[model samples]
Target: MKAIVLYQQGGIDKLTYTDYATPEISETEILVQVEACAINRLDLRARQDRPEVDPFPHILGSDIAGVVADIGPRVSEISVGDRVVLSPNISCGQCNDCTDGNENLCSRQKLIGFHTNGGYAEYVAAPANNAIFIDQSLDFSSAAAIPIAYLTAWHMLITRAKIQPGEDVLILSVGSGVGSAGLQIAKLTGCRVFATASSDQKLQIARQMGADFTVNYKKVDFSQFVLDQTNGRGVNVVLEHVGQATWQQSITSLAKNGRLVTCGVTTGNEGQIDIRKMYQKQLSLLGSALGSSSELRTIIQLANNGMLNPIVDQTLPLSKAQLGHQILEDRSNFGKICLSPTLSAE
Candidate 1:
């Protein structure tokens, strides 16, 4: 199998496209023939340095949608030729957190692509239970976009923040995968959305997606803009994933008793808060990681029914994984960028 193998983490140039042995499935795992895989910011981070890249010659891609090519002896639920999307989170089912339905919080959880070889290749092996069947009508690229971006956004806004109808919500980096997904989720829940992006084009797209207010953060203090828009009350919830760069503003843009949920920190991780203001406002700060497989199933159902759509900005051949990483690094895309292994020859 041909794969983009990372011998060492440093630059995009380190990602070598070469032939490697196909992964062998264990008794409880299945081998998937890669159809489409989505590029994520995490891929870029792992490519540089993240400490989790193990066993050298690693393959990095977590959002995977593929066909079951081979099933393990113990994998009775999944069959070969099944159209599926692999849940990126692999957790110990016997752990307390897992038994309590908090698999995302399981201390022994291992993320696909980060902790093991991922979908940057023609074939990859995953736990059989991690595979979720998707409607054939849904394209592989679209299914590939759902696992990480949609699941994270769903967990943040729906599960963590617990946003309600008619409330105001602010989403940072509105052009990102999580940001775009959050926008759709907020709109479906009947919330008035405030979105921030670095460019006017992205802001325009947000407005098209039912964002009530859009701001070019590069031009002004988005927090002040949110305050002005909401008549100084701020939003009920703030979907914050940009980390230290927007931490203070996200905190300031929240209303009294507002919930601030964050998933990632693309720009460094240290942020200071005014303890007095936090207490006075009764603000809630929440940290989120990937969501449970059950949540991913709900997300897939929504996608299948057309209630939620995965916004795909573009598709690149698997061989051009380097270019895909570069696009994400440039932040030039409005939504998820996908890689199709079937298009590699093209």
Candidate 2:
């Protein structure tokens, strides 16, 4: 099997494309023939320094859409040749959090590609239960773009913030995968969306995706722009993932009793808050992780129904995984960047 194996994490150069043994499935696992895999910012951090990379020669890709090439003896629900997308979160189903449908909070949860070997290869193995069936009409690349970005956005806006129709919602960095997904989800829920980006081109793209207002954070204060747009009332919900860089502004951009749900810390992690202002405004600061498997299922259904479209800015061959990481590092893409084993690097 051809794979992007990381012998030791350092830089993009460490991601070497080479032949490796195909993964073997346990009784409860399934071997998937990789069709498409999506690159994420997490991949870059893991490649650089985030101590979660396990075992030697790790394969890094969590958003995977592929066909079931073989199944374990105990895997009865899925069979060979099934078109599927593997849920990135692997949790202990018997835990209290898992039983309560909050598997993202389970103590025993493991993220694919981070805690285990993942889909940067011709074939990879995953738990059979993690496989979500996709419609025959749904393309693999699109399905591959859903797990991390869309799932996190859905959990943040729909489950955590509980945004309502006609409300004003603010989405930061509307060009990245999760950011773009958040923009779509806010628009789908009938909210007036305020999006922020680093470039005019990304802002234009955000407008095309239903953002009511767009601001270039590089040029102006985004929170002030949101306030001005909303007539000083600010927004009801702020989808904040960029950490320390935007934390103060995100809090300032929120209305009284506004909810700010965050998922990632692409910037520095530590953030300070004005305790007096937080109490006076009655603001709610929420932290969200990836998402539950059930939420992933809902995202897949939405994609299948065409209610939510996973934006693919570009697709490269699996052999070009280093280039994919470089694109993410530069933050040059408007949406998800995918890698396909079926494509030729040339």
Candidate 3:
């Protein structure tokens, strides 16, 4: 099997493409022949050893779409030759949170690539329950693009914020995978959408994705713009992922009792919170992680029906994983960047 291994995480040079042994699965797991895998900011941080790096020579990837090449003895629900998308969020299914249908809240929750060797290879081994079957109509690349960005956006806006039709929603970092996905999701309910990006090109793309109003945050105060657009009422919900850089403004752009949901901290972690403002406005600040597997299924269904779409910026061979990381790190890519172990699809 061919894979890009992180020998001693530091730079792109550490991600060396080479042949590695195929993963062996336990009785409760399945071996998937990976067709496509999507690049994420998590992958970049891992490459630079931001959090912590252990167990050297690891494969890094989370968003995976592939075919079941083999299934373990205990996996009776799935079989070989089944096409599936592996859920990136891994949790111990017997925990209380898992039983309550909130697996993302489980104490043992972990991301696939972050906690274990993942899908930057020709084959990946995952729990049988993690593989969600997909119909033949969907290709591997598109399925690979759905797991992280779309699922997080769905959980933030629909499940957490409870967005309603005609409400005003704000989406930040419009060029990101989550940003673009959230823009589309907000429009699904006929909600008025406000989007912000650093460049005009990204703002234009956001408009094409149904953003009602677009702002270049670099040149203008987006929070003030939101207030101006809503006649000082502010937006009903803010889909905020960029952490410290935009955190304060996101809170300020919200109307009274408005919801601000965040999933990532691409900027800096430690953000400032105004206690007085929070209490006075009765604002809701929510932190969301990976979504429920059920939400991923719903996203997949909508995508198959053409109501949602993956914004894939580019696709490269597994050997060129470093190039993909460079594109993402430069913040030059407009959406998801995917790698194909077998170069199966673009």
**Model 1 segments more than 4 A misplaced:** none
Model 3 per-residue lDDT at 343: 73
Candidate 1, residues 77-179, lDDT tens digits: the string is: 9889999999999999999999988899999999899998999999999999999999988999999999999999999999999989999999999999999
List model 3 lDDT by residue over 1-346, tens digit each.
9998887879899999999999999999999999999998889989897564434678899999999999899999998999999999889989889999899999888788878889999998999999998878888888999999999999999999999999999999988989888888899978999999999998888888789999999999999999999999999999999999999899999999999999999988988889998999999998898799989999999878777878888879998898999998888888889999887335
Q: Provide the lDDT at 124 for model 3.
A: 89
Candidate 3 positional error at 292, Å: 1.1
Candidate 1 TM-score, C-alpha based: 0.98
Worst 10 residues of 2 by lDDT: 48-57
Q: What TM-score does candidate 3 get on C-alpha atoms?
A: 0.96
TM-score of each: 0.98, 0.99, 0.96
Give Cα distance to truth, residue 114, candidate 2, Å.
1.0
RMSD of 1: 0.9
lDDT per residue for candidate 2 within 275-320, as digits (tens), equals 9999999999998888888888888999999999999999899999
Which residue runs of candidate 2 sit more than 4 Å off their true CA positions? none
Q: What C-alpha lDDT values do all the predictions have?
A: 0.93, 0.93, 0.90
